[model samples]
Target: MRTLKQALLALLVLSSAVADLPTEMPIPEAFIGSPVGTASL
Candidate 1:
């Protein structure tokens, strides 16, 4: 149970990081060519 809680917390932190990515940039056509946008597709 303790390990599960830790895993959940880690997931929350990682989700926040992913959420921050789009907010950090416009993600325009230029970004689409990058790995991040391509992976999203």
Candidate 2:
């Protein structure tokens, strides 16, 4: 459970970092199954 939480946090941080890097940034396989929402809250 702890590892999963850490992985989620890591993925979130990684995604934000990637999003800021550029539009052409590549996502690693570790982020493949992560959930994404179409609606912005």
Candidate 3:
């Protein structure tokens, strides 16, 4: 169907756009509470 083809095309464009985004996300400040050298388990 024409709608199905349109949907697939839109999905392809969206996926390609998402793939171009920077992969490395910065850690949020709230999650970085531990002091530099210490490990919490």
Which stretches of candidate 3 lie above 4 Å from their native place?
24-41
Q: Candidate 2 has which clashing residue pairs, if any?
A: none
List the candidate 1 regions with Cα displacement exceeding 4 Å: 23-41
Residues 1-41 of candidate 1: C-alpha lDDT, one tens digit per residue: 99688667655655565666667565465346554446546
Please provide, for model 2 over 1-41, each residue's C-alpha lDDT reduced to its tens digit, 9 standing for 90 to 100. Answer: 99688667766776776676556544543244334311111
Clashes of each: 0, 0, 0
Q: How well does candidate 3 score on lDDT at residue 8?
A: 73
lDDT of the structure predicted as candidate 1: 0.58
**TM-scores of the candidates in the order shown:** 0.49, 0.54, 0.51
Q: Candidate 3 residues 1-41, lDDT tens each?
A: 99688667655654565466456733333224323212212
Residue 18 C-alpha lDDT in model 3: 48
- Report how far off residue 17 is in candidate 2 (Å): 0.3
Give the clashing residue pairs of candidate 3, or none.
none
Local distance difference test, candidate 3: 0.46
